[model samples]
Target: MDSSPHKLYHVHGIDSRQFLEHYFSDEPDMAFGDDLLKFPIDSLRQLFTVGHIKGDILIDLSLGCFIHHLYSASEFFKNIIVLKANNRCIMELKRWVDERTGAFYWGHASTFLQEKEGYSDQFGDKEGKVRSAIQHVVKYDPEKENMTDPLVLPPADCVIIATLLDVISKDQDDYIRYLRKFCGLLKPGGHLLLIGCLDTTYFTVGKDKFHVFTYDESFTRKALVREGFIIDYCNVKERTAVSDLVDYKGVIFIAAHKEK
Candidate 1:
């Protein structure tokens, strides 16, 4: 591989299914699956269960079509609106939401959440609840004044963003600009949950290297504080799985509330 900067993920026509298989699949051979998938799910479950983040409407703007974290989110928020940066992600998520043929399997994620919550024989029910809670999944443009045009959304009570800022942002300033935009979507004192990788410069999706802004835990905290967020909870898990697919040092989950 040349020393060229990673190509932008959006421009590369990322394959949503391939991305999931490489990062989120539960197969035994997928070494980084636990770090990329289960870690965030577990962290989100812990944050949602701690009882500080409360809301009726929760908006998710995550990387790709991943919905494993929403299994826990659906339990707390009555209304979930998922915003995707592209139609491919939207369509892929809808395939699962609609339970269409050939949808990617998420039973492992559902089962993990079920076991964590100490529930039995509720995997099917959990999936249904998430599907019902998600009222809409729409494509959005970050540059637009109204990201969700023709469909005005009420200010969200809570917003969850997972590994997306790194993909969309071009620099530190761009990352902070996007944070301000997210803050604008929330009500006063609304909560924000962020999931990201530490010191990661790129990720691979079907042999394509996509750029990811390199950032650290301290930088994330400072960025959040600079964007007028009061950090509430933060957890960072060290990278244990070794993979040549991506060069992430660790994973970080931060829960914060926007300053009123």
Candidate 2:
């Protein structure tokens, strides 16, 4: 629609179930408890499988629906700081966190994660732990020079930025700039967990179309390395499910660290 960057990632006010289901994987083969969560779940598993990724602070710089990976972090980190794209998303997340009425139905994802983590049939316990682990829900403005102005948070031990990178950036330079900004927020030797859509330049939500920066695995790795992140592990999933909204070819997950 307008030329300004779209705030599609707001977690609140949207039909979370329908929206998430559609975006993640709406195909018959990739429905609930299916392929949509595969890469992310596996990526987190890969992260922990190596060794402990525990830290005091874990920041969720992910695109709107962040719960997909939150459970994995909850098991390791003590506190989680989540950044929202807009007030709606902030409010939406708070509703769930506070157990208020009209909150999005996240039980599916909660259960999905529980099953992934070997806590099958313990959805309530998983949900409670996730709720406890998430400490702060901060608002983020991509245009601001100081994105988190008036909020002086401790540098995070880890920053997990997914899907947002493809949408918030208009060019390679912008991606690099954002990466550098995020990297600056981490403690030395801290890690960055990134997930992105490959070869995608646009995505649609209902009737509205949003922009995404198209790139591949090589570009992603080079961008991270150029922005001062060391590669720890990376996995790329070939595009399988077709989407009516975006024409992305694949998804990639990268775990990296910034050396002192």
Best-performing candidate as measured by TM-score: 1
lDDT of 2 at 173: 91
- Candidate 2 vs. truth: CA RMSD? 3.5
For model 2, name the residue pairs that clash: 11-89
Candidate 1, number of clashes: 0
lDDT of each: 0.87, 0.75
Lowest lDDT 10-mer window, candidate 2?
Answer: 7-16
> What are the RMSD figures for all models against the true structure?
1.2, 3.5
lDDT of 1 by residue, 19-131 (tens): 98998887988877678778888998988898777679999989899999898888899999999987888889999999999899999898887787786966678899999
Candidate 2: residue 260 Cα off by (Å): 1.0
In angstroms, the error of model 1 at 54 is: 2.5
Q: Which pairs clash inside model 1? A: none
Please provide, for model 2 over 183-230, each residue's C-alpha lDDT reduced to its tens digit, 9 standing for 90 to 100. Answer: 777999899999888998677666556667888899999998887788
Give each model a TM-score. Answer: 0.96, 0.87
